[model samples]
Target chain A: MLHEPASQSGPDASADYKMRIGVWMFLLYAAIYAAFVAINLLKPLWMEKTVFLGLNLAVVFGFGLIVFALIEALIYNHMCGTHEADNKGGE
Target chain B: MAIAIFLTFVAAVLGLSFYFAAKTKSASGYFAAGGQIHWGVNGIAFAGDYLSAASFLGICGMIATAGYDGFLYSIGYLAGWIVALFVVAEPMKRLGKYTFTDALDAKFNSRGIKLFAAISTLVVSVFYLIPQMVGAGVLVEPLLGIPHYAGVIMVGAIVITIVATAGMTSTTYVQFIKGAMLVVFSLIVTVAVLVRGLSTEPDQGGRVPFYKYATLEAKEVKGALVVNDYKVLTSVPAKAETYVKLEKGGVQTWWLRSDKDGKIALKETQYEVKKADGSKLVNGLPASKDNVLRQNGGLEAIKGKTGPEAATGKVGPFEFLSILSDPETRINTWKIVKLSDGEDKVVVYAPSVKPGNKMMRPGLKFKTEGTPIQKLDFLSLMLALFLGTAALPHILIRYYTVPSPACARKSTIVAIAAIGFFYVLTMYMGLGAVINAALNPVTDNMSAPLLARTFGTFLFAVISAIAFATVLGTVSGLIIAASGAVAHDLMDRYLQLGHTEKQKVRAGKIAAFVVGIIAILLGILFQGMNVSFLVGLAFAVAASANLPSIIMILFWKKTTAKGIAASIVTGMVSAIGLIMFSPSMYDKFGLNPATAPVPLDNPGIISIPLSFLVLVAVSLLTQKKEASAA
Candidate 1:
């Protein structure tokens, strides 16, 4: 027997669309994150090179990834929200 | 005053838990907070739950001691939330009822899936709990002046009460409070750091100023170097680069050999030794106030600035990083050398001067130019942190507390933003500790708290209480997850014990009590082990055992029950097995690390991929059999 969901809410009508957007976003972020590890591994000295505001590539890139994730999350939420609103009535 | 504040915080948390207990009558209320938590509250709570003692204390301590290498953890950890927000959050909300096992086994009611997933949850939770519990004990001794075991028991009992009384409801609120307080107070500390700016001589609150090394001309008489009428007992031939050990007045200390303009000079170092007789000696003298390793860490000079009182007072965030990146600026960092002096253990806290440009870069703790295996170890750790956050049982279970998939997604975004902001502040807090003479030579875990003490006693008390709350929040969340695995997944579903709602809630409470006790014992048993290392192991285990099955099941249509079950077992066993014999564990076991079979300390690089391959193979093999049966 299939176990029921804990919440009483019905199945989401926009789940497929949301999943499509989510997968794309996941791939994009994973690539960016992978490049960070790759750069540290392959070109270690490159991190020491001064980049922005007298900070090295290591500090700048590290801070950039964190900020980028937040901006991407907000954008993802907004895109999904707009799509859900345009297609199905907002949840 | 700190004790009073801590007691007040504890009382407030207990009161909140008992208040929620009256409303948490059913199993749903106990397990998932009745799916009624507001997205905003749940979002902050997620941050609180996720930022355990490891993130707040361990990472800050690492950065304080090791520089930019520690921030790698903050980056990797926050990166993992991208996976949570974009992939796991919504589906988890839609599928899972109580625990992570609920989501994994939802598609297939196979007893194998239930049993294995529950086991994985419990294993991951228990491993994760050990570090947080140990960190609690570690924090308490310095902050509250209590014994370590007593601190561990106090945290265990309080967390058990919080979980058993109201389960997710109380845990969520506790996490929410902690998360908010942690962020706000860290921001205050960061602002304090920025306002104070860079200083060559930081005020040390009337304590003895940092020990300055004495430079003396190297004079050798009768094959022994003598300084201040004291005989050097062991001289290693004043080479251009080597430290020489000397004894005077029953105290032994190391002196650096420096050759400048064809003139040799010897510089004194601070060293501590623990003798076989259980007596401690500092600077070759019996441990006393007059002779000890003075507070370490400060800037030797600032760029384009002159004089001993040179300071970059009140700089912006960008300027702070910029000033530290100057080529002429030098920061004092301590390097610890552990050696055996006969039957006694000698630990030398040697001061090393590094250019600010190099200090802010990688290679302090994780050597980029190290061996290929060492490089791979860094990769494995990054991969684990990148993939581990979404797979963690306590984190996954939070998705169910929200009402809808959208709420789950929104809450995750909120978590990412709040946690990211706090992580950004960790850089400042760590750098603050590094340049402000705030590090405790004994433990790096106390760096953040000690940095707060540099600001004032009030901020220190508040930060310590919040850090303690951080441990309590995370431990309660882990216990709730583990309890749900046992009471809801194992007992009710896998074994089909057919417990009523009340019985199920009671069982969960009992499980929480037992797990809390186990955590306490492990915490006390594993004292002095690296907290960050234990946390990294948890991340590796979670990423290995859970992520493969989770991603495959959600994305792949051909995933079979056998695939999920086999994948979970393979991933869990492989990760645990590798860790058991890994070089780090070998060192922990008091054996030579080089003799260990596993080269990689983190199992995620190998075991995660292995799990995915096993799942695909098992699924392909069982597809035809399952098709025929259906």
Candidate 2:
């Protein structure tokens, strides 16, 4: 009962925030896929790994992601509104 | 030999389904453990559900045949969990409703967001399901001697029935059961490994090394290796193969079949003599392009060898055996040397899927030529595993099953412990399969079950059944996620199909059925690729498309719903589009990989960051636009 339908929520409910967000995300996405295809073609130095597990010192290194995923979660709760949507359920 | 026991497993799973059928009257009960699972129980269940046919069967099979490189995969997979616990676990709980899309639409209420998220979920889910279904198909063929397709159908039907009958509730509990059993039984097998220990020598009457790659007279085609050429390679070990001995040409040869059929058999084939120092050959040029090289990945292959060279690859006391199964480097592999009648020598390259690689895909792909398939494979897997875990709709829903965020967090902690422990045991089982020489050759997915068979039929039955349950639990979870997209995201969110709670639940059930069908078809389409690798792709898409939007919305005030919507749509679309055009799918769809649209097989290395950057840039530019309108 708390969250109403889009048409029902008030003038603010129809906010184009959704579309705006979608477009931004899509651009970044397009860019990333492009880069991936490019890397395969280029065969950059970092992508070269003589090691056993196929890990590389690539431009798109996995070590950074491992660090980032952990950091993003702990330091920030995805920056969710502790003020507005504070009604989160507890375990 | 294990057909009766396999039948028993199928029966047991079906029996369990009948028991839970009545309780699954509602969609909620079927999909999310009735939102009543305890954090601890669900935690273990999560671990169970996550380990699939790939982990149990593939890794052990790879290690048994391939060597040290096979074990490296296990380490990479286990390492990925650390990323999940610290970064993804808590935030994912906060995102979405029954699907990853729900959380995305919270801020924007955008149809674009809903559509894209649903599409992405379907794409990743279908890709992931293929391996599971294919593995099932592969398993039935050997254990039951049934056709591959029959096995696929059996598993697909059983999984569909399970999801249709018990929904999330049964799935969760079943996962817990499978996870616990997989770990415990594997421990028993590992003990068997230590007890029996490595044989002092190969062909010691009954026992042998994990694998025996042989060719009575192997022939080398362009991409194919044949039997005739194997004879020449083995016949003249006195030739250049044995001549240029800088350190005894590092080659492993076994005597199995001289011909395609067992009609022509040889008792032995000479392998390149392996001294202690020679076991360290990590990389080298193809010895001869025409030499026919064969590998025996499973124990069955060893028992069924048809030639003398079949045992040539077998190394002494501990030099080859010890180095072969190490997880760090893939040294001491059975190199294929294909010999032709007169053309050129050809070598068939066979990679050893390490336990970690089989456990989870490595996150390494940069779209480059210098990059070996292994590096590309490693990156692709890591990308998917890291990103996919949090974005899973079923996993997210598990948080809501608990009483509070604290419970969600606690459940994740428990899950980490259990999953971590289980992954550890998988390594032991993988190594055990090597020494026991009871590994499955072609499909690494059958490693764990075959390893169990080496001990006794009863153990094999239990292990195989647990693996089946593992499939049941995961497939059920995926179907629930897909259904949620249909019912909640597409129907309710997009169409504005207002309905009562009862109606909503019913809609979900129907959606589950449809998704189940879709999963079955996809499972059949992409059969050859490993399941863990497929799952890794799923992870990459989920992480790229869904995770970024959710994280940005929760944390950034500048994030208007518009930014959130855009990011989710982009991430989902781009990742899916890329995967569809990828070489992996192209071959499946009967298209040439060279002609395929997407250049790189994996999209994560680029797609993930693109998501984050878009959110930040758009949020900055459009901050005032939303404020004035409000």
Candidate 3:
């Protein structure tokens, strides 16, 4: 029933994942920050409503999910990938 | 590969338990890291312990469903931390042991102190524990597509195993992982929102429109409604539809669409007529009923609908706003419904813009746009949030995990950093769910997960697992508290079992299992209630019930054991009683909410002060304290 995998390197699993995740997250943060400031200043001469998965422009933006997703998909996945052997097998 | 990934995550955690369990050979190691964990690690564990199902699922769901008002909870939760920092954190570490009882009995060793403190911890922790287990049950359904009961059992078994095997050692690490992941990932989600930018639209990919027709119930009678929260006019087919009878001058017909790419097209038809003047009137209370106040629509627009289940009556317009802004009205919400179809339900919310305000969300509350009630609601909520943090039991216990009082202080700072950043993200997460318009109607608890789902199944899986882990981490901490009460406070301190350390550890493990079972039962009992709101109640109880005793004991040297006993019993009993007769509780049990006796959304404003008063008075009367008990 206990599902958390033991890291071969111990707490370093999360720490390592955290650092890598932090880097991508910060990158995503910077990109979003740049975009927010740019648009407010430049106000984009002719803005078109961009659709994502069918959602409107205003609804699509935020920092948490973007930074978080990169962390999970890129950072944790990479760090934990090599440790798949430790995961419950044939569940 | 999909199953593999899921299994891998689960197996990894279990393996860690085995590893930690191996290292956790002593009682101290199992219960508070033998007071030896790193400050940084303990800090994250604090986050893990604090950010339970209620914080992630309940608050996020409320925000997604309610709008700006929903975020008030997050504010209350974070604010509660300040109390922890200045009041409980340092001194608690200084006076501490395995449980809060030890601290109280430190100066005056009396049975009265032992008995009452044990009861208070058990009552509060049990009250708090139910939701975590129930949330766990609720969580597994979407993840494994399993039934709720099965999920509850699964979580119970797993938690028992983790606690039984490694006790506090593994629990601490689990919490740390969860707390860190939640903070970081939430930050990531916020960044995504900013980069993705705001949208005045809905996700069309898999969004469904079902509010085309909804049934409202009052006193067991049900009626069909043609609900349309239309911003622009669009005609709904009359072929099989019963038209809404519009008065001559109401806010005549408006269109309701889930923004630009709405899957379900909705419209509203209002015609508020004037007597050559402007006013509203309904059956009598004012034919001017604003869309008649959707019980579910107060925050944003979706989940606030009122019915037997949460999403039934569109809960009329201005319902929650009335609760939030008004002092007399306690929201009596209904339990969740199965909906004949059995596909489960979702709520779709849309945010509105009102100028010159600290926050935004439209059609939510009249007070929002410069109303006196709105200001009061904001103040009440803000006051509670700021003072409520440190009073929480789960949050309090994290302090003892660190090696020294110095580390405990440093850990709080780290927690503030992590927790603060996450709270900032909750705003975007809530708003993201709203504009995305791809939200679950029945269980507002599903907001964040549903939001992740809008992005893709992979994100959904990851978020769900993380959220599940969140439930595990928080529930584990809460259960630990309960078990400590049983083993450390009741068994040893009160009952004087005098069992060796191994036996004490075993008793705690057994107690954990019992508490876990109780939590599952409570989760099922309070099915429809939002986890976070309930958690807020828990915090209110903790603050009211435990905080006074702790504070008074720490400062007042003349404190008598009887005084502490009286304060704890009074706080627990009063809070539970107030909650029982609360409009929210009455409504959930399918009773007329009008019968409720309490007058406030939170009892802390009154209860906290009452507890303090009781403690002081009793202390004064029972002075020269210890001898009387003998």
Candidate 4:
């Protein structure tokens, strides 16, 4: 009962689909973050320059990352929920 | 009043623990809280468990001391949870029964998997526990007038009782309550900071003059340190010769010293006041009680002194940052310097006056522009903080508390929302501590609580108690993870002891007590170290040892049991081995830190990739054994 083998045709297919979406999100997020870090390492002085209204580049970019994470989470959650809903209807 | 409030909070948590003890009759109830926590509640509990003293005390202290750089930790920590949500959450919930090891061993019933995974959990948990225990010790001295060790032992006893009796059920509620209270109180403080705005002079005291020259007139009399003369620019403040300003090159500054680094350094000048009873009072205060070098406290000048907006009496949130960013602002802050000349070593408590523009930039600490090693150290620290969140054993186990995979995912999003908001509030709190002019000279961890004291004793008491609760909640979660690894994974699963559910629960309780004792001892031993640095080391170890294996098993189709086990051992050993001989460790041991074999303080840059390579190579070699579906 503990080790129920994941069925291939029913819920497994949905799980597989969700996994692919998860991978895609992870990659996109990682790429964007890597760019932010690269800027920090290579040209840290650039980050000190003011970009927004009175705020510097580092503050703007840092807050931007938080806002970016929130958006990604909401999007992924909605997509996965929709996927689950569609699969349930198919059943 | 503070002591009464502290005792009340402690009693409420203990009462909650005993009440939940009745509900835990089986291993499931003790280990995973019966898998019945509401997703909303469990989500916030995740925030409660994750914040620790590091976020509340350490990050704020760093910000109070280092400015914008401290908030970087907040950003890095919160960003790492995205990996937890996107990659680890659903699969972890779907596979694991009680502990993180349960998920790793799901694909293969390999003893090697359980053994190594359990060991990794213990190593990471213990490393994480030291900081929380140390923070507990720090709180005890100021709040209850007890020695550091007594506070550590008190927390150890309380946490062990909570874990032994109710287990995860009690721990979860403690975390939930602590998390909610921390966020609410932090919000209240942030609003207060904005309302009070920025000021050059403290409301309580008159301004002190800034000097430019300081000469520590001391000569070696035989083998003892003797004072010949101590003179500099002086206004003759009430208590004699304890402080002096510098006036170098016609620029009146805050400090003066003989070191090559001519930058302003404040020294807590101590004068010997020998009493008839053989007791000593250095500078009007007893040398024995909490007098770790003293710094002057009154504020000197405001940012805009004579303009239309002079003093800025009270400003809004954005206006606060602008005021701190102004070049005209001067702030008094501590700069610790360890001066060792041959057999005689003197620790100088150097204070400095710095401008707002310099404080709002990076490179005060973690010099990104120094040497190649320093820059690499900064990047490596960021990498570990970003990747370590998903790999932490205690965090991974939280997934099992939820019923379904969807609940697990939703809970993670909820956690992100709450944690993100709290982190944004840390910037204001940390800067507010500086602007409030109540920083604890010796330790930055006391920044938030000391800032609260400026408001009133009630706010101060509440903030301090909540900080202690933060320590308790985190330590309990860590102990639960450690206990699960011992009883469920090591004993029942790996050793094939075949214990009944009741016996397994009993074994877990015993393991919790043992682990709590070990944590208390280590915490006391590693006193005076910053909580954030200790936490950074924990994150590095977790990232190196556990992250690569977890990532590979979930994504790579060719991953075998042997590969996973080898990676865990390699990652754990290499990271810890390097850290054991790291420069920081050498410094901690009172040896020449430059003589350390490993140059880098953080091992994630080296060990993380090495772990991945070992996993891939081992997986290829063991390909003929079995192919687990990804």
Candidate 5:
């Protein structure tokens, strides 16, 4: 388990760092998701255009969202782990 | 043989539950699985729990019918999990002891918070439970040839046994197994769909052609509706009449029913046998003799080159999508239209041919050109789906089953990965059902399983059995959540019963039994509705009621106990109240739905924002102490 040792970084500082990382990641995802919805509402015709192989713009964008989510999760996990390790080492 | 396979799956799951019962002797184990479940198992269990019948059966059926419109829901649902992973998971695991109510009450320890949060949990769980039970009844009907009520009762009993015996331990294991099975089988079927490719030709052995029948006059006889002059017409104009073909004694006859008034409506048709004595016998074809499943037909090629125009044979996945986007592929889609009655009454599903390119776009199902109210309705549904997943009581409670905050976060990530992959596979499987002609005319929910049946009977049997298990897993989770709200949060803490651990466990088991019975009755009452629609209602409720309270508490320092309690009640009541007076509910009451006060079908676009406003208003009035401390 990843944790900040109490002797080094206090609980409040550790929680603050974790909260910032979580919030940033959430905002990044929300932006991408919101963009997809905006396209559907404002310019639905753009979704019908074929972008890759036989896949249309709507489909490619959807697939992009799923892939982006997985990537973001991995990045968040790794960053949070490294932050916890650095905090523990400071003791 | 299929029945045998189905029963075996049920028996094995039951035996697993009974075995786990021994380990759940303590209150903690019964409610939270002792917080000892491996993160990996719990991750897949989350997928299993979240991917109710709506995900597997409903989405596939929607795609099979409406094309890309159904896949939009997949994006919305998966996106909601991102909120859970980043915002809710770690804090939830750190704060709560067992149920979701425990998490919100962690700061204030107020009885009012506990009372309303528990009530919110129960209402949301019950709302979510009905769809799973209804989907269960639907699956049982086609698989076992039993009545719909019997299937609902069987699922209720099995899920109750699972919850009552081993509680969260058994529920977790069952979800893990079923979730893994659902993903793997969906992948296999999707690959099979790709390999088979697209075809324009109808089945060779059983080619049922179209015919038009003569109009029959209807007259009132003794206050009963009766029709006369039932005969098959040989010839009619091609464009303006309803056509049907009937086969008798290995001979096929074509009949045309004209569009003129008093024309015979082809409600249904069967064979009548004439004996030597000039008497006629009307009866059904025997199931044993006529049991072979038939392939769906009516798909035709609209845009094709001379070579591929004949048939694409076996195309690659990219090639398949490209071909479907071509304008020449005409698909027969079922459309429900209103008749002269003007109300939603006389709803009839008329078959219409749509070009492939149009089907690949959004306007086929959710009309964008309609009035602003219709557009708002679409946005409202999307908003609910995008926000609902994290707020669900059953999904929230799963965070407590893991050992640490890290485990909770890891499990959510794993769930997103697994769920995301399965949702992608659903698009292919749904489209496969469409081109393969696997739709049951009456109910679109049968699309995925029927597509599996086209491969082989054993695959069909396995898919059907797993779908039933899907219902059981989800329903059990919901019941556990509901029972936890009753025995742990409400009765023990709020009511000041202060029950012992042993007493709490006993009370929880009893609560599960009672909730399960209520779910069964509701399932039977709401038969024939599409499972996806019902699940949407549940999501709206969860998003409106629980989400505002959770987000406000986690971020807002000024949030008081009264604010949280008031928001929970306001969100729950407003969403449900709007639904009750909405047009859909009016239709359920056999009243003129157009006369309903609420125009929008989904209440989230209104209720969610209203909840936030109520929370802020209430908190400002009651925030003296909390504000001073901050």
Candidate 6:
């Protein structure tokens, strides 16, 4: 027989909403990351093209990904925190 | 001075550990910091825990040596944190009490889940710990002037004391301090690099300048010559390749012919040979202070510059990269070749000049024009890094330190911000090393610290100390995670040991000690081995073995305990097995790489999917039995 969970906590009212938003965002990021690998594989020389601010595509895209992730993480935290606060008040 | 700074860092870390030890009496406190860590502190600590020596030294060294290929690791590593935040962070906080195994077995609570998860945790932690320990040894040599084994033992002893004394509480604070210092210092280094800017002939500060090359007509070249009391044996092979082997009083070096309009132009190469008799030679001389390999690597020329003194001072971040990306700019990069000469192993370090535009792009190490297998290896490595961060036991357990899911999410954002900013700095630090004549051509791992030295010895000392702290913080986390797997999951939960809280804590301390010693031994044993590959292997294993089970358990209702257990074992075994038989390992074993059975060095593309398949198939097969039993 399976043992019970070690501690009992109340159900998270915001779990489903968070899950929906989180999965969608994860998929979006995954697609973008996949494109990075694909481009490096298919047309590696294209990374040399100066696409932004005189930096090559490689430097621009690589920096963009890191900055983009930070922004996405902050946005996710804000949305999740707000949703949690709303759910707690309603409950 | 570096030793003094390093000792001070160690003392502060120990003081913090002992301070926390007094308050950490219970299992909860020892294991999870009593779940009271502020989200902001926990967030920076997360960055500390995640950015191991591999991320700092290895990636920077890679960028310094290989250019754009090195940045790929930074991109993949940071991207993995997204998976952690968006998918794993909140759910993990809600489920786990002490360890990640607690979360995996939360719903089922099966002994099987506990056993496999604990084993997987231990394996991954140990695999990760070895590299950090080895890196500690490597850093200590330059910083503290100690032998490699002493450095490994020093780190092992300190980390063990920290984990044994206060466990996760001490580990978190160490990581937090380390994370903040690393980011701030890296930013400073980046600023210094920008201020120094691009120069064709960088001021080497009285150090050895770049080595010069010589050219001769093919017909003018004699079979042998004696220059400066050194015997030079020239060989002109049928394949139009010309090379010269130089020997001076039993010392050996090699120079390879370079392309110069069909002329026989020979580029100098520094070589170290270890004869079977155990004697060593450096650059055709005995291995000593005066016979050391000359430091090389700097801008051959900057775009639109007519003379060596031309400089681009105080360039902006974009302008720095832009100047480097210019077609006319050229920089020096080294290519390594290993050969055996009559039972003596010779490693030749040769420098090649490439256009800055080419170096700023992705083809140097990843081999965009290489074989299909090479491309697959690159893809697999990126995939593993992307999936591995969320699955690492050390990274996952940080969730339990936070009080709420919201804090966990908040802290994750903090970590991403701090870590992302540091990665950006790494690019500058790496490029700075390339153009500053700061590379230790033999050990690229010294790039960042050496770059610091180019500024001043004091900065070098401080950077090296923080780097050592970086290793200490990471090792403490890994050891604590491993101890948790042993004390909490394996001994207490899986075996039903029924130990009291104090006994469990004692058991954890003992486990930490044992793991620390084991890590130290392994670190010493593998002293001169390349550490980057070990880190890559750990990531591949973590992604392959742990991620599929994690994703399935959280998302799929049909994920039975049997499926989870099977998936974890399958993933772990398959990934490790593939790596062991991969081309790289074969080369390590002194066998021909082409003869290796596994085509791909990284097993993520195969083992990850294979693990998912095993979980699905096993879950389907066991679903009926599980339902009937319930």
Alpha carbon lDDT of each predicted model: 0.88, 0.55, 0.59, 0.80, 0.80, 0.86
Model 1 pairs whose backbones collide: B251-B284, B252-B284
**Candidate 6 runs further than 4 Å off:** A1-10, B205-231, B234-242, B246-253, B304-306, B341-344
List TM-score (chain A only) for every prediction.
0.88, 0.39, 0.37, 0.83, 0.81, 0.86
A26-56 per-residue lDDT for model 5 (tens digits): 9999899888877777777888889998888
- Going through the candidates in order, their DockQ values are 0.77, 0.06, 0.02, 0.39, 0.33, 0.58
User: By DockQ thresholds, what CAPRI class is model 3?
Assistant: incorrect
Error of 2 at B241 (Å): 11
Off by over 4 Å in 2: A1-91, B1-12, B24-30, B62-80, B91-97, B200-381, B580-599
Model 5 regions more than 4 Å off: A1-13, B202-298, B305-309, B336-349, B625-630
Q: What global local distance difference test value does model 1 have?
A: 0.88
- How many residue pairs of model 5 clash at the backbone? 10
Q: Native contacts retained per candidate?
A: 0.75, 0.04, 0.00, 0.29, 0.35, 0.62
Question: RMSD for each model, in Å, please?
Answer: 2.3, 11.6, 15.2, 5.9, 6.6, 2.5
Residue range B1-630, candidate 4, lDDT tens digits: 999999999999999999999989888889889788888989889999999989998999998888877887888898898899988998888778888888888888888999999999999999999989999999888899998999999999999998999999999999999989999999998887787766555541222222222344433347433333332443223212223333445533222233234433344342333455666544335677665443333233456363224566667776676666666666666555443223323333455666766666666777766789988888888888889999999998888777778888998998888898899889888888886676766688888887787778898899999999999999999999999999988998888888887898899999999999999999899887878888888998899888888899899988888899999999899999989999999999998989999998988888899989999999999897575332
TM-score of every model?
0.96, 0.68, 0.68, 0.89, 0.87, 0.95
Residue-by-residue lDDT tens digits, candidate 2, B468-550: 66776777777777777787778877787886666776787788888777777776767666665566567677778777876
Best by lDDT: 1
lDDT over C-alpha atoms for residue B360 of model 1: 81
Give candidate 4 regions above 4 Å deviation.
A1-13, B204-255, B258-310, B339-346, B627-630
What is candidate 6's lDDT per residue for B301-407, written digit by digit as tens? 89857355568878999999999988899888877777667687778777678888888988888887688988998999999999999999999988888788878
Residue B325 in model 6: lDDT: 88
| lDDT by residue for model 5 (B1-630), tens | 789999999999999999999878877889889888889999999999999998888888888888878887788889899889888888777778888888898888899999999999999999988888889999999899998999999999999999999999999999999999999999988888887777665331123332221233433448433444433322223345433434445443333333347444443322233344544333223224253223343366636532235555667767776677667777766544332221211223445667877777666666644677877887888889988998999999898888877778889889999999999988888888877777776678888898888787888899998899899999999999999999988888789786777898999999999999999999999887778878888999999999998888899988898898889999999999999999888988888889999998889999999898999999999888666765
Error of 1 at A25 (Å): 1.1
Candidate with maximal DockQ: 1
DockQ of 1: 0.77
